[model samples]
Target chain A: MERVLDMTIQEVRELLRKKEISSVELTGFYLERIKKYDGSLLTYLRVTEEEALEMARDADRRIGQGEDGPLLGIPLGIKDIFCTKGIETTCASRILEGFVPPYDATVIKKLKDRSFVHLGRLNMDEFAMGSSTENSAFQTTKNPWDLSRIPGGSSGGSASAVAAGLCAAALGTDTGGSIRQPASLCGAVGMKPTYGRVSRYGLIAFASSLDQVGPLTRSVSDCAVVMNAIAGYDPMDSTSIPQPVPDYTELLGRDIKGMKIGIPREYFIEGMDEDVKRAVRESLAVFEHQGASLVDISLPHTEYAVATYYVICTAEASSNLARYDGVKYGLRIDGKDIIDMYKKTRSKGFGKEVKRRIILGTYVLSSGYYDAYYRKAGKVRTLMRRDFDEAFKACDIIVTAVSPTTAFKTGEKIDDPLTMYLSDIFTIPMNLAGLPAMSVPCGFDGSGLPIGLQIIGRPLDEGRIMQAGYVIERERAVKKIPDTLR
Target chain B: MKITKDVVEYVAHLGRLELEHDEVELYTTQLDRILDYVDALNKLDTEGIEPTSHAVPLDSVMREDEVRDSIGVDSSIRNAPERKETFFKVPPIIEVEE
Candidate 1:
């Protein structure tokens, strides 16, 4: 089991393929680990033990019939944000506590089609709102590196679980650095494709414009494997780009000689952790040695990302989350009238951070402030995208610190919404630009906390971005398995 | 303050949310700070720039309008808090004015 935990998903695939280890056994092994470790980790929202075993059983049966695929029989953790049929998807909010979807999310359906066993729904920030997992209505997921620290969120559970080997790899959503920031902090590989790259048919809408389903994986290769399965156009999602899905695994071991790696000056700013900056600075040689050129660039509108993002995301969230009025689903608090019921239910059902965003969102999109906040943010968003477009003209890929600092202590920034919002400073810009970016573990800080740098690619250039990340992952080869596991 | 307690109350009302007195007070301070912070966007010159709601330009796809399978009423209202047969049962929405 220890050896299996160390081995990549590719190796697990080989083992399952040769009938050396049945899917049931592998599923059980992961389940046992989850049982043993998750108590301390508090990563999973709920472990779908029976469902996983049944899926594994189905996979083993299919294997007997000579069926094979990339993710066949692999056990993975899923963020609760995605709607899974017959399974309750709360998105870490009290309001949707008992709401079970009648159908799987498009990405969920895609993964199900690939015969992947779900370990369970992992925890996330309520409505994927806050930066840390402390906002979860259920449990605060602790960083596996140090139990005192938070696993960076809102995909904190997914990254923490994957890092601790609770699941081989996990699915997470990145609206504003939910995937990459957590993945970076936890030393797991997380990839967020371009905005329209993945289908969001059944993903609980956060900021519809910014929300994207992505993978947090054990390795860069595993990230690619999962991406290959989940990336494609779905008719159900209008925003999903109707483009051919590339085989992401094709450039696993390929050389990236002469590749231009853009280092945006704006992302490497004051207030960034010195160790993080040093790690990124040191990686310059590593990239150069791997036959890549480091080019200095500037994203002028980078500073405005956090502000712009807050306005737009909140505005969209206000509109999206308005559905949870206690009428059609989840938790309900009865009141005198329908409006009163909505008021009562939402007030009680939502957490503090969720309410804060809802209020902020409503305020921005409200009659008087829409033009100044929402529309202004929208125009600035265009500027941010233009900055990326100009920079991409000279470079194939960009590298920047995934988080300004390492995983912060739980409740460290929870009280201060502005400070907590800054946790995603480095990552928010990429989301605004709608580019493919990945968090690959770079090095460790003095306290052995993992540091990561995002390898960003142009729009729909996930394959290229992944190839560069694969290179860095190989060069760094930092200790991925958390000490908690050891 | 960009957002006062009364402003928070009005916004919460518009959002159909019932905020406690403290919540309104707290949100007033926090939202003011956030709004003040976001006030930096006014510095940028976006005079002639079109607001791009989506980063990528999307062309509407021409597809045949066909009746396909839906989640159905049973599944749709299955999670409803109060369901009367297929329709979602709700509290009195239209108030009859005396």
Candidate 2:
């Protein structure tokens, strides 16, 4: 059982198939780890121990009957943003504290169909809003590497749990840098697929246009397995493209003998940490050594990304979050009248960051400022996407630092919203362009926090991104269980 | 160009959000700074460029107008914080002005 914790998803599948271990025993091992480590990590919002065992039992029975699924019998963590049927799915926000979904999110359903076992719901920034997990109204998730520092968010718990070996892998959402940043900071591999690759049918809307569900896992190949399960066209999400899904794993072990890698000039500018820059530059050098020549590319519209994302995402959030009126699902506070009720419920239920975004969104979309702020941001989004489209013509993929720095200490940037939003500059451009990007662990910073190499691919070209990421993971990544866990 | 308290209050009202007085003051300064940061977009000329509402181009998705199984009222109202006989209960929508 202890050895199983160190194995990748494929290794565990081999063990499970050869009758070497039952799903029940494997899940129990993970449960014990969670029981022991979660107290210090605070990674889980809720651990559905009984249901996990029951699911594992079901998987065992199916395996006994000769059923083989890609994620069969494997236990995984779920970020709270993905709704689980009859389970309390709080996007780490108080507003939805007691809300239980009537149906599973499409991604959740896909994983369930594959006989995957659910470990529990992981913590995140409220409504996937903050860069650090401190914004969760529940408890702040501690970094598995260094407990005092934050696990990057809003997928903080997912990354931390995977790094700590609490679960084989975890599902996370990336609206901005939520998935990749945390994965980078926690020494895990996280991908934010193309915007419409996965179905958004039951995902709680943040920035509807930008919100995407991806995987955070222990290995790059594991990321591919999860992506294969979840990435598909769903008519349920009208915005979902009709492109045929490719086997993401096929690109692994792929040779990039003559591939062109792009290094955007804007991403390497001032204010980036020396260690992070060094790791990224070294990663490009590795690609060059493998016969992948590096091109000096420019995504000149990079600077406007953070600002445009704020305008766009907040506006969409303000609109999507409007459904959280006191009368309907979620928390409701009584007031003298209906309008007063709405004000009280939202004001009290939402966290500070959520409230701030709602107001900013409202102000931007307000009558007089509509053309100046919201509309202008929209046009700038076009320019940003065009910047990528042009850059992609020059190279197969783009590489950059996942975040300017590794994980900062808890409460470092919570109070200062401006400074906090700027740290997201590196990750926001991908969201705006609606391209697939991933963060594969490149190296550890001087302080031992993990550094991630951001790989950007053409729209719907997650295969190539994984190809490069697999190379980086194989050659450079130093993923290991932190000593704290040992 | 500054985001004044009144503007924040009005926008908050429109968003159906109520902020404490201190929150209003704090958001006023923060929102001002954020809006100021985004003010850089004003310098670029976007006269003919089209706005991208969705990154992937989308068209109206026409589906067959057919009845199908949907979540029943019982399940739909299961999460209502305040419910009255399958209806989400709320405070009175109409009240006489004081």
Candidate 1 residue lDDT tens string, B4-98 = 78888998998888988888888888889999999999999999999989877887877898898888889999999899978989988787899
Q: In CAPRI terms, where does candidate 1 land?
A: high
lDDT of 1 by residue, A1-486 (tens): 577887888898999899999999999999999899999999998999999999999999999899999888999999999999999899999999999999999999999999999899999999998778999999999999999999999999999999998899999999999999999999999999999889998999899988888999978889889999999888888888999998999988889899998988888778888999999988877889999998999999888999999999999998998998998899999998888899999999999998999899998998978999999999999999899889988999999999989989987888789989988998898788888889999999999999988888988999888888887788888898876587
Q: Which one is best on lDDT?
A: 2
C-alpha TM-score for every candidate: 0.99, 0.98
Fnat score for model 2: 0.92
Candidate 2 regions with alpha-carbon error over 4 angstroms? B96-98
User: Cα lDDT for residue B63, model 1?
Assistant: 83
Model 2, B6-53: lDDT tens digits are 999999999999899999999999999999999999888899999999
Cα RMSD (angstroms) for every candidate in the order listed: 1.1, 1.3
**C-alpha lDDT of all candidate models, in order:** 0.91, 0.92
What's the TM for model 2? 0.98
